[model samples]
Target chain A: MTQTSLTLCCKVLCVESDDDKPLASPADSLALIAQERANLERDLTPDPRWMFWPWGFAWLLGFGLFFLRFGPDGRVFVDLPEWLPLTVLSLSFIAAGLITGIAGGRSAMQTRGPSSRQGLMYGLTWSIAFTGMGILFAQYGDALPDDRLGLLWAGGMVALTGALHMAGGAIWNDRQLFILGAWTSVINVAGILVGPGWHSLIVALGGGLGMILAGLLGWLRLR
Target chain B: MSDGTELDPVIHAQARLRVVSALSVLREEDKVTFPRLQESLRMTAGNLSVHLRKLEDAGYVEVTKTHQGRTPATFVRLTRRGRLAFEEYQEALRALLNPTSPSTSSEETL
Candidate 1:
């Protein structure tokens, strides 16, 4: 139907509440059903988390880690100690975690469908899987070359993140998130094939751009 | 004649039907705020209040008025009775729409 017609139908449907009025014609009933379905679709759309503060910090974390790993011309840009980047990365994660926890807690209090506990479970699972992978890599570090080790780490992180996103998206039935997860998964495989030297760059450019774009889209939607 | 008559008049009205339909999709404990419901239904505050009062009077919906800091917020959720009434209304509507169908007779027996 034309937008004008739909709006007129919706307006009619919204205004008619009198019990004394004649029963709605089949066409009118159909229109009301259509309008109701549209409203439900609009309402059930998930909150725009990409616009949240933690997401912005997540982008920073990706870029910061990339810069730390590659460095500028083999020299640190800020000439900081080797441990400083790790410290910064850890701090960013803590900040993101805190923000997510606060936001999720507030959201859970307001809405009953999306449970904060479910989100915490997802996060805990990811952390455990990541730590297990790290231990395995450490144990096999001597068997692999230094360059290949970096590739494995980067690829593993990307794959893990993509898998989690895909899982969450599937559970929530969010198409945007599912597509993002698929895009990241594709990029992860492609980055690994390029080998170590360029893997970080690919991830930084691809993943960072993806996140920024998603954030911008979410912001626009909110506006 | 009884087919259409079986429908719940409280839910059969378009505005109230929309309200109950929206609330039905939400989790049982979830509450929709007044502004959100108004926007979704594209109705004026006064008009929504009237319909909400009717539903509240019928014991189909529970309306809560509370303060968020300095601002007052109105939240609404369907009661269990409300959900059941909505389901029965839907069944009656289907029967009315398909009076000649065998399935309608089977549904009516249930």
Candidate 2:
């Protein structure tokens, strides 16, 4: 933007030539630009907290049921059918995926342009990442005892999710997203260390509630 | 690049100034659709087209036309020089607001 390049005038008022007066005072112009810049920032990045709600609830309900069914000592507390805990986990994750997908897709459509493309790619990356994890786990999983097998599955999935969340945060430059990822990793490690039954309980309470808290914080900041 | 002493007319005009300000907020690699820009600024296509042409001629903005699937889309972004100019313009505005004050800008000279 060369100084000499500008030749326009509202009736020839622009430039160092100073033939015309500005509609906005210099102070007002600065303020207007500041306001406009903030507006663009808001539009470009809508509040992302809404995406976290489904995931939070899914983890809470799913893991809570797991904790109740498989207790801290691996003894059956609720006496649910053998298929119930795993089914609950599977269904909860699927539901979360569907809900977040719909919400993210709607946001992408509204934001449109590069953001939508980025969102699609990001969503695909999650699928590929989790699929890779599932395949890897299947290969070596049978060697572990039943209790260890459950821990391995839960721990591995939670760890992968944390890593992906961190990646997402870095890509978006979102502090909350990055912090949530970090927190998830910490709680996941804690759950694994406490053994199978305790792992379920920790993840159910910590991992599940952590996401909800993060979402709540985002809501507060937005308000 | 300006020394924060004089405002650049390229961005001093009202509408173009707003356009440049809006663009400066984006990440450097990001490009916005022409319709999005127009809608955000609430300007008519003809009006935006005219200012964009001026900004383009001044090397302040880059416009690209590409296809999103089967539909053609036009995108716009500020050039690096354009970003520098906008920053300098802000500094110039700051100085204009308080004229007898000592200029603290690195670009200012004794």
Candidate 3:
């Protein structure tokens, strides 16, 4: 009785004739029943593109790299003689993740149940929250210096964003969101290598353009 | 004819019952699309049209024709009488299900 199955049943029952008239009889109730069974099985298949573990593992890789570079010297990622600019950039990345996850999640729930759009939205929402909280802790707290804080923040946010994406993917029954989450993890690693300027652009493009495309794909398919 | 009575059993069969359930979902919403109902009920367009004509004859539902994009869409809604009849039918069903209940026996006595 899922909506897709119901729609498929309707499509199967429709007569393909030139005349815009109704059929004389119910026209093979058995056929409709058979079609329904097939569709139900198709709906039950699990998607393969789950992203949570992959992103976590990637962040772990980044964590190792960060420690390798700065651990011996006892300087964190942000403490490499960099200014307060990295702090500002981290804050922006976190904000973007939060905004996308919360708003996109709501919109996806409203429109298409748990389709691709919902997964994308949910991923965006988590991204914003995940990144934002990390940046907040890095800047305002009495914990560690900026560079070390940045490494810790990036590792934690990348892990979280990946987890959210995986959850959304499972809920929507789509792997695309999982892939996006994995991409965010990779982007985080890239950010570590490229410095703040390049990281900001990458995060914007990944969250912004990526979400718009997902939304458009849903609109086209549903409409 | 002078007193209010329930609809005939013959008129309450297959297509009409399907129409009733479909219309029930649209009681709060102003209207539902023709194609939407036809698809929901898994009925052919002509079979649906025939049942719809009967409902229209009974003054229980209204149909409006409009264009969605280039295609003609028929929107349907239950009339006030249709809503009342549906409620009355539900009440009767509840009574039938619990005929020995105190409230029902008392009403029967009355």
lDDT string, candidate 2, A66-154, tens digits: 77787777677788877788898898899888877877765554334456688789899999989988998898766988778888888
Better of 2 and 3 by lDDT: 2
Which residue pairs of candidate 2 clash?
Answer: A13-A20
lDDT of 3 by residue, A1-223 (tens): 2323322232333323213423212232223323433332222222121112222233233333444334434535444433334443445444543544445443332212134344566555754775578567656556776555555565556557656766766775667766766766777678656653344444445543444455455444333
Best candidate per lDDT, number? 2
Candidate number achieving the greatest DockQ relative to the actual structure: 2
Best by TM-score: 2
Task: Indicate the residue-level lDDT of B31 in model 3.
Answer: 64
Give the candidate order by descending lDDT: 2, 1, 3
**Candidate 2, residue A64: CA error in Å?**
1.7
Clashes of each: 0, 1, 17
Backbone collision tally, model 1:
0
Residue-by-residue lDDT tens digits, candidate 3, B1-110: 11011223322354575577556644243565676567666789999898888888888888888775797767777788877766554444344335466755555555
Q: Which of candidates 1 and 3 is the stronger one according to lDDT?
A: 1
Q: Candidate 3: where are CA atoms >4 Å away?
A: A1-223, B1-11
List lDDT for all candidates, in order. 0.65, 0.76, 0.50
Q: How many backbone clashes does candidate 2 have?
A: 1
